[model samples]
Target: GGEGGPNAGGERERRRGGRKDESDWWTRFQNDFPWDEKTTRNVVIGFAGMASAFLYFYFRETGKEVSWKDFVNNYLARGLVDRLEVVNKQYVRVIPVHGSYLWFNIGSVETFERNLELAQQEMGLDSTHRVPVIYGSKSDGTFLMSILPTLLLVGSLLFTMRQGPMAGGRGGGRGNPFSMGESKAKIMKDNIDVRFKDVAGCEEAKLEILEFVNFLKNPRQYQDLGAKIPKGAVLSGPPGTGKTLLAKATAGEANVPFITVNGSEFQEMFVGVGPARVRDMFAMARKNAPCILFIDEIDAVGRKRGRGNFGGQSEQENTLNQLLVEMDGFNTSTNVVVLAGTNRPDILDPALMRPGRFDRQIYIGPPDIKGRASIFKVHLRPLKLDSSIDSEALARKLAALTPGFTGADIANVCNEAALIAARYLNESIIVKHFEQAIERVIGGLEKKTQVLQAVEKTTVAYHEAGHAVVGWYLEHADPLLKVSIIPRGKGLGYAQYLPKEQHLFTREQLFDRMCMMLGGRVAEQVFFGKITTGAQDDLRKVTQSAYAQVVQFGMSEVVGQVSFELPRQGEMVMEKPYSEPTAQLIDQEVRSLIDAAFQRTHQLITEKRDVVEKVGRRLLEKEVLDKADILELLGPRPYEEKSTYEEFVEGTGAMEEDTSFPEGLRNWNKDQGMEESPQEQQRKQCLNTVSHA
Candidate 1:
């Protein structure tokens, strides 16, 4: 009757649902919840229900009625109720309490919350019903969304710390360590302690460098007067002649920045790197204006390009190009000057030596006598030398001994002297020490203890005595200093001479010296009755001297005034400097000249046979002989004898004997005054009687 009152409807519903139907409905409801896909949904729903129930009870006890309609509008829609919105027919909203809610389509939580917030704000709902925003959480329920970005940022920071400034916040690259790559052309000031005074034996080079230094200091003085300073100067010489040292001294005197680098350092495996480095070097030099860029051994890079087949792809060629550009090309100015040093100027490219590039080429040759003496003084300044040590005499001796020695050799000789003195525990270096040093430098050490057979000893002694006796008789020969039978270095014996201070030689002098060289073999022939190979060095010397006389000095009458300055390659030819017929003539002449010299030597030795035997025997016993021993055996020279022509010519033969005549003279009559002696008067009367007859 009233649609069967509420209690009657409930009884009818229960009567229609049996136990099996109830269980089926419960299973169907659980299946509709999508528990696998949304496992936490049921838990969340149960918690929300319990929390709402507690709040409702608490509010109701406080005299606030929990209206069903109000709850549906506020708690259900906003607080206590839940509905699923579906886009079927007209956006149907079904309550979650019924199983029919399973058919409703639901938007994602983010979309739903966004729409609900919009609607609630539009309707001006209470602030307590509004949803809160999570910073990193999105519709997918992911958390800590900034973790990847934070990790990337930290990694970038660490990379920047490791890489330094030049690299773009990345580790491990070719970055300069000290930020010194961009520095201007500057030398290490601490190591630039080398002053001009420290350099030795290159006075000419030093003077030239001093002018450059002055120009660097006052460039305006020349510039104002319409004069241009040399852009560069090339120092050319043999090695160890102080070319590089002069350049450094110039830098020091100028007191400007010095950029020093070897020419080889510019070349690299990468072809373009050389040019790039050259550009960089020049850029630095330009920035440090009024500076010197010293390139040592410049021939390494500045060789004559395109002359040799070194493969067209040469870094040295590229470097040379860059150097040319930097030296005289578009960017060249007077501010930067180039200084190049090399021993081989002949091989250098002409471009490098042209007027604008290297305007001056200074030659630093081996030191002369004065320069050598000065060099010795400079080197000996630090050593303990006796006051009596004559640097000039030492220099003269060294100059003679070292024909092609540079300043560096003199320094080495000084160092060797010091070492010799040290070995002897000498407080100061004396003349003897320097002598030993010279011998060590020139002929190597003496092997005095070397054992030789009696025959070998005799041969050595005769050989050395031959040299001494021949040198004594030959007018133009160098004075004998020592003759030794002792083995030294490669020689079984040796004869040392006090070489004259003359650099030029006359033909007579050369011939006389050659004769002296031949004297050894002559002596061997005269004494031993046969020649041994002990005269190998003498033969070589004599042959060379004879050839020089014939070809170089034009001393041979057969090859009159003919000079054969043979090329270095043509030195080995047998019939050199003349036609075949002329060669025959030259050979004959050379043989005749050598034969006559040997004959003269043989005759002299025969005349002074006893003296020669005595000197040779003494040399064999003692292994060495000074000039005094040689003079004692050979007796006084004819020049030292004071006998007049008249005394000997008249047959008076008054034997003049004056031991105390003078330091130089050997023969004189003590009783004979400025007034003629009785024997001299008798000799003059006999000469008059002979003239009268």
Candidate 2:
């Protein structure tokens, strides 16, 4: 009994084990899902088989369709002797003995039978000799085959969802194909390399940004003082100023999460996509609290709503509305600092620029002389320079030469200088390279191959020489540094002038500047007995200055103290604030001022004919003349003037800030421009050991 019981129990256990083993195929299939290569191959093969069956059954052209009349007149009447197959009780298929089969649609089964009987009788055939009409039902196999591909496609998508690469950790990584409204903002966990000292020229804007960084680092300090952290700050400036760089510096210094998204990223063709993206972006910022959220080029979405919105709701307006709401919804204790950068603050929506949303509106204009010097020092650190080069002195010299350069322009100059040095295979960047770089940035690439005729060259030389001589002698005129007859950009020649670093000017200064602008035309008229289009830029400057004196500066007696903004060329103005007679008087005043300046320039050039003649001959012989050449020939200016390098820096708070270089650039190699620090060297050696594995 014991043996029988044990054997029976063992047999039952083996049967259960066999059942589990039989089910393992489905279990394994479920675990691997669509990721199993064999399973995927089987699925593909099955789908292909079904598609082939569908195509073959549905697209067979042998049994072509025909009208009911054609089938009756051609086949049954002629006694071509074919059998009829009625399919799905809706159509009849005729099998001809000689050729291919033809089918025709029918209205009703009873009507079809009656018509066939009548046709047989009309053809005068007996029951035995009549065409055989078979009756049968055709299934909906063709209809199912026609829709099989769509069904397979949907099934394949479901199979893929089980194990898909598209489903990233966040249920589809930013702007996910599955989630179209997801935020595409780039998130950084304080991984930025930029610091405050790396950004230069916009020192005042930097201070306001620094306050945000300080608040992020120590929120309690401000909270204890009964002060609320600013809701946001908008950095508005002309392009190429350090607006975006300051924002990055704030993020770098805060040592917290940073999320940056461009304003244009929120724009979409879908009506609600933009607003949804704005919501997702702000929610993401909240998720990483104490982070800086920077929106670059905010003017794209922040323009005043309804100004140009004609009909339907604008997606841009919706985004701006959502952004306004998001900013207002910020909790005071949440340390998400919102910073935006834009060049067009004038067109921004009033709600966006309100006191509660963007509490601070910082302006970053083109850097002054001292600000440019600081920017130069920051950009010039990586280049190989001679040991004899005094960095501070070089910075000051470059600052003076670049009168109205922004921080971006200074960086471009430094990089361009290096490129020029490399073009000549030089070991180090020199002063001449820097000078060429500045001219390239200002006047564009020199067109040395654009050869000129002798007469054209001579005319250019005299025209440029006239400017040098006039500016050299006039007490209030800007000093001339160089004159060249070599073609650069669109001009046949160019005269570089060291314009004084002064903004507020007297009537004498304005008049002298105008005469200098007209000097080239005066010199051309006097020497060549004609004028060329080479004076277009000069004439435009002269005209603008003249109008500035009359309309902008209110230096005209007829215009009185009223200053009206000049109407740009394509802009439309509905009405003038002053009467027509007053406008005529203003025009008369402008004409008189220009006429007086032209006469003064003509007289000045006439008196300095000898000096102009000598300078023009030198310019033609050398093709280029520097400040030293002019100083040696005609001597220095007689007026007491402030040196352009010293005055802009003396009392401006820019010098007190430390504009130091990062470690790699601070102690760069003397000869090879390599890093001199051991840590950098070790890092490089380690990088060299990594094969392209």
Candidate 3:
């Protein structure tokens, strides 16, 4: 019994080993056929088509094996044929004596009957041994043959449908014939980590949106007071002003899910697809209630509806109508808050910007001096700096340099500065790196290696000096910050100025600016005795300014306050908004303005010839001069203009309360003098020329 127990245990172990081998083999088989459900279905369909094709060819070929003469002579004569079937009376199948049936074609039922009887009688076969005749419908086989291609086509469509809309080819979502009008908006159930602190600048805009976030957080408080939380808010601003970032920050502040999409994504080339997508997007928003739906660049699909001229634009209009219904439709209680951003609000449909639809239109312009400083602070947080670098001073200087820079431009400047520092293998960023970054942003990189003839260099120096002198003399012109004779960007020479952040411009100021623009060309003619093509951009700007003052700004004497500017069009046509007489008058006015500006610039250069020559010689020697250097050569003017950044801190009284900055750096010291002793005498001569002007 003990021996029997041992044998049984061994046998059990063997059986278990066999089962393990089977399991391993099964797993290997599954691994070899590793495909997704869609791929597997396609493979099965392909194999089915191949099998059906093979069967069709096999049956078709086998039917033609025995000829009519051979069937009668070989099989029928020997009485080997047991039975005959006439299928649709076009083909006859003969049962063989020892194998499967054989088939032959005949003309018709009568012919087949006659032939079979003749063959049977010729063989002298009796009724029992004769091949019995039976008729078959053959309609089922014909039906399958006719429907095989349709079944394969339907199977192919099913395979394509299993794949997503992206696989629908180049047309993408809307181009695909099989798409079900699904929403293209991407859903983010998780809260975005960006907070309001991450978005710098646009403080007022932020404050406006903060209330909306609070409403989302504590809706019951507002609801109890019968105050409906705003259904929507539109963040209208120029590009790169942080509209999308504000939306993300708002989502983070409210701690709600975010569904973001572009307005263009809702439109497509197909009919009804755009509207369907709008409905689907709204349906998704409703399902994910208490969430934020942010649509970026809404102007793409929400332009004035009927203004679109193309056949496909009707689809976009349909989408806009659907969007309007979704935003402020009858389902008012839905918790989804819509946030749209656009750069061109003027192009939007009037109905789309109605009160209930976009309850608040938050305009986010470029940051002010104070706002820019805050933005710099936010961006500079991650950079490593030298101990000598003062962040406050650097921020103030950067804000001054970038008066019209958006948040994105500020970030780019910071990044460029870092890159410049890294290129020199420096451990920390310094003031010079930031200065280079500012130059790169405004005037582009310095082409130090570009060779210039001595005459050309002298001409450039005089040209830039001409601008400085004119700007220095004109009370309304911007103050000259720096002058450079070295080539940068497309210009052979350039002058940097500190333009005030003023919204309105007077006619005097416009005239003074135009004179400043013509300074270079006038100087070129005076110093070189001829003009060059270097002032092409300067001329272009002057022309535009003159035309704007005459035609667009309505600053002309004869044109009155009415603007004669033509309507904006995508195509070019030889048509003027005014009649021939008015057009001639406008042209004459523009030319008169340019000529007057040039004469004033020429006169100023002629009177200040001494200062121009002195400054031009210095620029030729140094190649570049900053504010202190320029002031050293030209002396103090009667008027001193401050940058917007300086005025902002001074007006707000924040300059006095700041403890981080050292005392001497608080204000611009006018005491810095040139190394030469003759600077004082030259300064007196410069003051005399400015007073005379």
**lDDT of each prediction vs. the true structure?**
0.66, 0.82, 0.79
- Using TM-score as the measure, name the better of candidate 1 and candidate 2: 2
Candidate 2, after superposition: displacement of residue 230 in Å? 0.6
Off by over 4 Å in 3: 1-180, 310-313, 330-332, 564-577, 652-693
Tens digit of lDDT per residue, candidate 2, span 87-152?
778888889989888888889999999988988888888999988778887465677677877877
Judge candidate 2 at residue 100 and give its lDDT: 81
- Per residue, candidate 1 scores C-alpha lDDT tens digits across 54-109 of 54555331223333334336544543334444332222243444333322223455
Q: Write the per-residue lDDT of candidate 3 for residues 242-339, one digit (tens) a residue.
A: 99999888776666678889998876665666777777777777877878889999999889976636655487787898889878673446777889
What does the lDDT come to for candidate 2? 0.82
Q: What is the lDDT for 467 in model 2? A: 91
Q: Distance from true position, residue 320, model 3, in Å?
A: 1.4
Candidate 3 versus truth, CA RMSD in Å, comes to 16.3
Q: lDDT for model 3, please.
A: 0.79
User: Which TM-score value belongs to model 2?
Assistant: 0.76
Best by TM-score: 2
lDDT of 1 at 80: 31
